[model samples]
Every structure is written in C-alpha cells, then in structure tokens.
Target chain A: MSELTLKANIDRPDDFYADLLAAHEGLPKAQSDALNARLILVLANQVGDREVLKDALAAAKQAMHRDPARS
Target chain B: MTKIFETPLYPYERSADQDAAEPVRHPVVVIGAGPIGLAAAIDLARHDVPVVILDENDKVSWGSRAICFAKRPLEILDRLGCGQEMVDKGVQWNLGKVFFGDRKVYDFNLLPEEGHHRPAFINLQQYYFEEYLVNRARALEAEGKPIDLRGGSKVTAVEAKDDGVLLTVETPDGPYRIAADWVIACDGAGSPVRSMMGLDFVGRVFEDNFLIADVVMEAGFPTERWFWFDPPFNKGQSALLHKQPDNVWRIDLQLGWDIDKEKEKKPENVIPRLKAMLGEDAKFELEWVSIYTFQCRRMEKFRHGRVIFAGDAAHQVSPFGARGANSGLQDTDNLIWKLKLVMEGKAPETLLDSYDAERVHAADENILNSSRSTDFITPKSDQSRIFRDAVLDLAEHFEFARPIVNSGRLSVPATYDGSPLNGPDVAGMPDRTRPGAPAVDAPIGNGWLLSRLGDRFQLMTIDADAPDRIDVEGIEVERLELSTNDDPSGALAERYLGDAQAGIYLMRPDQHVAARWTKFNEAELRSAVNTATGALSNRVETPD
Candidate 1:
C-alpha cells in the first residue's frame, strides 16, 4: 500500500502557521499546522478552486494570528 | 376629530390612507411569515434584495407542528446563522426503528456521516424555528436590510403586471395596495393568493382520514419511529407513534373510509381512539387533535405571470412521509437563488420558469412517494389489503422484502430531469451523480473531503489544461493539480492532491456534481462550461 502524501503551497509562512493554529485551536502547537494543512486541502478539494482555497487558507491564517489562544 | 379606534399596539397611529399609500417598490414581495416564508425572506434579504414579507397572522403560530428537520435543511439553516442555534435547541437523532403489527421488524441508521462540524438531523418545533427566522428578519430590518414584515395584513387581490405585480391588501387600518417586481404566495395550503390567481390544483383525495393527536406520555416511548400495521386498536387501520421535540409524542390513527371527517374532530370521538391506542389503563392528556384528510395534489403551474406559489400553496402531500412542511421549505430553498439571479439581471425572465419546472418535479416526486406510503399502510381496497398483507408476511422471512416493509426509497432525493439544466446521461441514470444531488467525497489537500460548493451556480473545471478557455464573464476558476496514480511517486499526487488522480469535476453551488472528465481539453472544457452555465454564446475571455 502506498502512503498518500498531500502537500499544498502557502504564500506566506506566518499566515500558514497562523491558520494552522486557528484550525487546531484546542490542540497543541505541534499538531495545529499538520491539521490546518489537512483541513485546507479538504476544503480546496471540495471547492476545487485554487483561488477560493487560497482565500480560505489566508482567512484561516489571519484568524490564528489574531488569537494565538486559538492554537 | 373623529374618534379613532386606536390601541397601544398602534403607537404610530398610522391612518388608513397612510397605510394604503404606495411606497417605494422592491424587487420581491413574499407573503406569509411562517418558517418557510421567513427563511425565504432571510436569504433574499441577505443577498441585498429589497424584499417585503406579509403575513395575515400578527404572531407566529404555537405548537410543535414540524418535529423532524433533515440534514440538508439544517445545513441551509446553518448558513443563515440559525442552524447552530437550532441544533442547540433540538434533539438530534440518526437511528430509527420500524415495527410490523406489534412485532419488531427491522431498524436502520443514517450511514457514513460527513462533516465533524455538522449533525445529521434535529427534532425541533416549527414554532421555535419561526422564532429564529423572525428574529433574523427583524435584525436585518433594523439595519435597513429589512424584510418588511406586515403582520395581520391580508392580500385581497394580486394582479401580475408587465414590470411586476399589483397587490390589493387589507390591513388593520384599511385597504392598501402594493406593487413589486415579483410576488410569492407562501400563505400555505389554503392560500388565498393561490386562489385569486385562478391556478387549478389537481390530485386525488385518499379514502382514509387520520386522527392526529399530540400527547405527553408518562414515560418516553422508543426514541425511534414505530408503525403498527392493522393494529388491533384501530381494527382495520394502521397507527403511527413518532417522537416530537419537548416530552411529547405524535400519534396518527386511521379512520376508515366511512367516517365523517368533521365528526371525527369532536373530542368524544378523538378521545376514544386515543384511549384505544394508549391502552385501557394508560393515562395521557391531549394537547391538540384534528381530523386531516390526505390529498396528493400540486398546482398545475407554480407561477402565474410574475406571481409564484411556494410551500403548501404550490403542493400538498400526505403527512405519512413528513413531506408537507419539509418540502415547502425545500421549495423556498430552490427558488431563492433563481430569484436572486433574476433580481440582479444575471439571468433572464426565462430563468424564473425553471422554478416551476424543478419544484413541480420535486412536489410530484413527494406526492408519489407519500401516496405509496399511505397505500401500503392504509390498504383502501380488498385487493390492495391482500397485497400489503402478503408483502408484510414475506417481510418476516425474506431480507428482499425488508426494504419494501420500510420504504427507504421514498426518503431519497428526487432529480430535476425535466430541467433544461440537466444534460445527457440524465435519463435512466442512477441518482448518485445527478444534478441537485448532495456533494460527494473528493481528495483535497491531505485527506478525504466531501462538501457542497455550488450553492449559487454551477462551477466547471477549477484547474484545467488551458486557463484561457472559460467564457462566462465574472465567473471565477481555480487551477490546481492532484496526485494521479499514473505518477504514484510524483509530487503532484503524493504531495498536493491527497494521493488522488488528476481529474476535473464540475460542481453546482448546492454542492451537487454537474459533470466530470478524466483529462482536460481547452475546447472541450470550454463547451462544457457553456453547457453547464446555459450561457449559449455568452462567452468571455479568461485570465491566462
């Protein structure tokens, strides 16, 4: 069985990490980015739009940065 | 000054002339303030359309008429910011049980649930549902995005105009008139608006009348649904026990063909029927009781010029499948988007015709299913009774007969095939990938993802071969790659596409699939986009 790896591009490092933190607001910082990455990919796959995915990613990132407590 | 019939509620002291005077016209006028009407008004108002919603009732009705809300309607409510609140207030259930004549037959559960953020179904009162919607309507009104709720105002006449409609309404003060670009009748089954338009509602009246009673039991019965075929209490009829929100239960008793519907409503007659079902010693107080005749009918046309009919006004189905109010709300859901498009001039008046096509199809499907359910349980004729009994008997020994006993197919969503939006492969095709079907699971960034994206319009090829081919102006496209099996070790699939193959799938805003292609070709994809949008020659250049 092959281990499917999913990767996505993040325009900004802090934004990506921030979105990661916000998505996993209740989780430890170590798990937040990985979880955020997974969530972003899922939504992008659903919308299937590179633009909306980017917008969703940026929004998630901004939310995390606004409140580190979200992490 | 002449003595005025003013009350504390009339703080503005509004006069007959002032109330009757024509005000600035809006793009849409929605009649009725019930849950369906308010829900329709909320969505249209959110899209910035000037809307007026009128209801003859001064206040929302009480009693938990509609108890169960499906996942789809719940999701729609959530989008309007009221779903979460509804979830908080209602009891959620996904598992239900069925009984055949006092014996447990089988049970089923809503399988493979999606979305960690959303629940499958909620049991809440229609009264509370209206409360949430009305609050939203009032809040929007405060912000000047008002829903224009004219409570206690009755529409006496509605005439469609070239530009819109002219409505003659009677208010507390006096009669007044209103003109708008569109008029929607959501006033319910006995809609005056539907009558004034002279639209013929056609269908057959069932032979059986149901004595519906809502009672508070000493102890909660099974949380799941229970149906008894030919129960001893009713002798030759079937009985249904369903859970309502609060600590109550709704029971339906079949009154055979010979009983008078009006006389059956009398408490004396209703009490005996209720007592028989509750048992000789069981004690319960009835909240409300009514004798309802079943009719599976729909207006021949949902629209008369600029005036449209929605909910019960447009169609009526038996309560066997809980299709009445639920279908009405779904009607509004389908209409709101098209109305928004026409209001914005994004689509022509022809687009409004699709409302009748799609919704009438839905209504027809509901009627067919509900009628079948009624037939199976009621068994009007001797031949039908024999057939139903034979099936129920076979259901005991054969798994094949189990589905018939439970009727799962009746609950599934119906397609809008007659719809011009539907393309080839629609005929005789299974509903799995059809238009208006729920969204499916797809590979996103790193994991399996399922979502309903095309809530407003159809989306074709987000990331395709050539970025320059899409022609609809103002249409947005996204370009991206997913991992394909051909390149198992390639970064595209392993790193970005969640280990999935590269393919293009078109989505409708309601999150149903329109079409899919394994590979992208610019000319082919361009044509697909045009077909999906119904744009014909209305093409615009795309950014490379």
Candidate 2:
C-alpha cells in the first residue's frame, strides 16, 4: 500500500534510533505507548501519503507477528 | 461609560385567555421572539397564518451579538419584506484579508463576479438587525395579518400532546396556558423549551475564550474583514476586526483557556489590548464587551413531536464564520413555508420532517466548518501548530497553499443533497441546481431572479416556454420564463444547466431545487411536487 520505493530517508540511522528510545526514557508503559502512537501519527501527517502510511501500518503489524524464523 | 443602545421595550400584553372564558387555540405558537423567531412569525403571518410569539426579553439583543448577515439570509428576509431595509442600514462588504505572524498570507474576494442582488456579507449589529425585523413584524401586525408578539412573556413549560403542544407562559401577572398545533423554539442557545423537553443540546465546548469588544470610533479603517494570527499586538493568539455601522468596530481577542473574566472585561485591561492592536493614538470608547467560549455543537434533531427548534436554540457555532445567526435565519426560512402548507392541510405532516433532516445537515456542516476554523485558529497540538504555520508560510509565496490559511469559513447556504424530499437528478444539468441546490439568482429585466421566487412552488424555465399554471390540491406552482438576453452575464444558465440547451427546474417554496431536467413532462412535474410536499409519489417521467 505504501508509495515507498524502498528509499532510505534517514541518513543517521543510529542517532535517529537513539533519540526515539531516549523519547521513551523514564515514562510509564502507558505513557510511552501514547508517545509512540502520537509520534507515528505526527510523522504520518508529515509524510502526507496515505499509501505509505497504510503500508507502514501493515509492515509494523506484520512485524508484530513475532515469528522465530523472521526474528 | 458608553450609553446603552436606545431600544424601546414593548409592553407585555396578557394572553387572550386571561380576559376570555376559553384559551385561544392558535394554529402555531412561536417561542423566543428573536430575529429567527420574529422572522418565523412574520413569514407565517404573511402566509395568512396567525402566530403568537412569546419572549422573556422586552427589547432587542442587549448588544451587537450576531453581526454578520450573509447573502442567503438577506434573500430570505427579502421575501419576509424586510431585506432592503436591513441592507440599507448594514455595512456590506466582501473582501477579507488573513495574516499569520506579521505576514499577509492571503486575501479573498467573496463575490468575485457580481450580477446578484445582495453582497457576499454585511456587518450589522445584531440588535439593529433584530429591531428591523421586529418593526417589520409590527408593520404586518398593523396590516391585520395577526402576529401576537408578546414581549416580557417567557414560556416556562412545554407539554406535547397527540395533536398539538400546550405552553405555559410566565408573564408579569401570572402563568397562563395556551395550546397550539405547533411550536417553534428560538429561545437562544440556552433553550428552556429544549431543556424542559429533555433534549441534549450537545457538542464540543472549546476551551479557548475570546473577549468580544465593540468600540465606537471615527477611524480610517476600510470596510474589510481583517484577521491576524500571532499579531504584533497579541503575541501568540488570533484576533479579528470588522467594521459595523454607527462607526463601531467589532474586535475579537483570543484569550487562553483560563482568565479572570471580570478583570479581562475591565476598561483598563481591554483598552490597552486595543491600543496594542490599533496603536496608541486610537481613541475609542467601549460600547459593549463580553467573553465567549467557542462552541461548535448542535442537537441531533431539530424537530420533536409537535415542537421544533431554530436559531441558536437548535445549534451554536463558533463566532468565526458568522454561521450562528446566518444559519439560524436559514432554519426559519426552511421551516415557515412548510409549516404554512401543513397547517393549511395542503401537505401531509411528513413534509415537516424535511426541515429536521435538512437543517440538521446544515447544522452539522456549520459545526464541522466552525470546529476546523477553531482548530486552525488555536492549533492546540504542537504538530497541528507546525502544520498550520507551514501552510501559512507557504501561502505567503505560493498560490497553492493560500486556501489552507484558514481564518474563518464564512457561512454559505446549504444544499439539501440526497434529501428524501428532493427528486432524482436528471442528466445534462449541472450539480449547482440539481434537485438539492439553491436556485441561482440572475439579473432578469430590471429585478433579480431570486426576488421573483414568490412563496410558492415555482417552475423556472430557461430558453423554453413555461407551464401555464399548476392548480394542485395543497400547492400553487407558477412558471417563470427567461430567454437568452435575460441574464447578460449568462452565469445563471451556465451554472443551472451546464451545457444543456433548455431546462425546467421545480423549486420548493424556500427556493431550494426540488427537481430539474433538460426537459420535463407534466407527470414528472406533478411527481416532483408530490415528493416535495412530503406526499408519496408513484408516477415517473423520463426527460427527453
């Protein structure tokens, strides 16, 4: 569903990942979950691509399957 | 201190039941004699229906409440016989400018092309507007078309029966009872009748408060709508400026969620805020000052049993967009004619249901627009603020993003699309006048096309001869013919019929299109009439 051409957007992957984890630091589980949800929606609006958002949603949901082989 | 507006308080007369042996059973009784209520009574009265209008207040609105009158309402009031006077008294303008943080982002001309009777918008104090309506109502009353406008009389109780509604009014003397077949409640947003009937006047109440100040000044500001986001005077809030009659200016300052109401209303506090916006040399006297929270909410149903609601009582929108009073006036416009037809036994009661469906739809639109404007003006969330600012920033240079800069979505007449009362659309006709849209006005002869849409069903024909006359059971339908030279601009024919050569449009009493076709047969016209009046229809005629 994504309009993604499998393009890499972030140049500094480690720093981006570190900052995301840092955003969740010291927060309770519920609050941290809310922060992630808000961030995802905010970024989606920034993307302004419905197909990409839907594809990202399917991909994230698929990753939630937690198959041992895929992991 | 500025003097209060000179509005004469009418004497309250006791109900006829107080003097007579039996209570007067009227056909219709309207509650809360505000602009909408008075308009309803006047309209019904004009339709030869006797109406009793009760109100708690003895005078017009305390201040300039609903200041902007859009074009549609002016047209409706024209039929009620008071449109021209209001237009003459009001300041009419169409240009609006929007700013974002010291940058003039976008400006709009509401009526880009003009051959119409009314302007896009008019700025008149609500009190003055209501006074004009009340005077017109009185004029009709003097002409013997009965409009019992009882001021200082408040309806305290409402009891709905199988046939009609019984009302209990609290006057200076005592509470008296009267029964009417129908009741229209226009008693402001805090409707006693709605509360008494246990309806949820529900919706979102915006946390942001705006200090509304009407100041009298002889300034050089042009008659245009000016909106500012993060203006130099107000650091991070939005503000609005509109010029009204009597050299008065209406300014709205966006105050945050919490503030000391009394302190904010003080002259010392309000004056400095005005000074910051209009510069230090702007000498002005405050005429009226009040604080209001933005509320974009409405009732699910405007009609209940034998009782109905209109105006602020039925729906309330944010002050932005000027939808509140404008939509309310439209509510009455959509209602009165139907009420007349039903009361006269010309149509079935089902005809009234269209008012509920149609106005609820209109109210929903107003709420959606008002809420969006509120969000854009306030932008509670950081990301939304970022997006809004981005639109504003882009709008400064590029034309594409200009529309995203939302100051207010001004009120426009609602089209009753997909309404049960509307007949199925035919091909070749444009969507603007297709069975649900308002009839487009055009310059015909020396008058306007809309001005001729009398209070009856009409078949407007373009480039074709009209039907002789429709003598139906409960309706009077007439035909109006217009040739190519009738409209010099040709916008009317273009919008109403697309590229079609000729057509017939069946319009309802309220000037809403009920049906349209490139060609219509008598049977189809009758079917459309039946459907429009809430009567069941079985006949069908295909367009040639």
Write down the C-alpha DockQ for each prediction: 0.01, 0.08
Q: Write the per-residue lDDT of candidate 1 for residues B1-544, one digit (tens) a residue.
A: 2111121111222333345446446678898877788888888887788788877666555456666676667666755657777888787666666666666666667653442345555677676677778778777778788567777677898887788888877776777787888888899888888888777888989877777887877754667666777777877777877776666777888777788877888888888888887777777877767677868899998978788899888899887766777777777777777777667665566767777887888898988888888778877676566556656655665555556663323344455664665533323333455544555434444543333343454333323443533434444434333334323334323322332233455554444455555456555445544444455455523435
Here, model 1's chain A TM-score works out at: 0.37
Candidate-wise lDDT, in order: 0.65, 0.84
lDDT of 1 at B411: 40
Cα lDDT of model 2 by residue, B1-544, tens digit: 3333455556687666766555568889999888889999999999879899899888888878899998889999898999998999899887888888788888887864576888878899988888888889889989999888898788888899879998888889988888899999999898999999999978898898899999999999888999999888887899999999999999999989889989999999999999998889998989999998867778888999789999999999998788999999899989988888888788888888999999999999999998998899999896677667766766677676676677889899999888988886777678777787887777877888899896899988888766768866547788887675787788777777687888788888889899887775777787788888887554333455
Quote the lDDT for B245 in model 1. 62
Collision pairs in model 2: none
Q: What is the lDDT of candidate 2?
A: 0.84
The deviation in Å at residue B253 for candidate 1 is 1.1
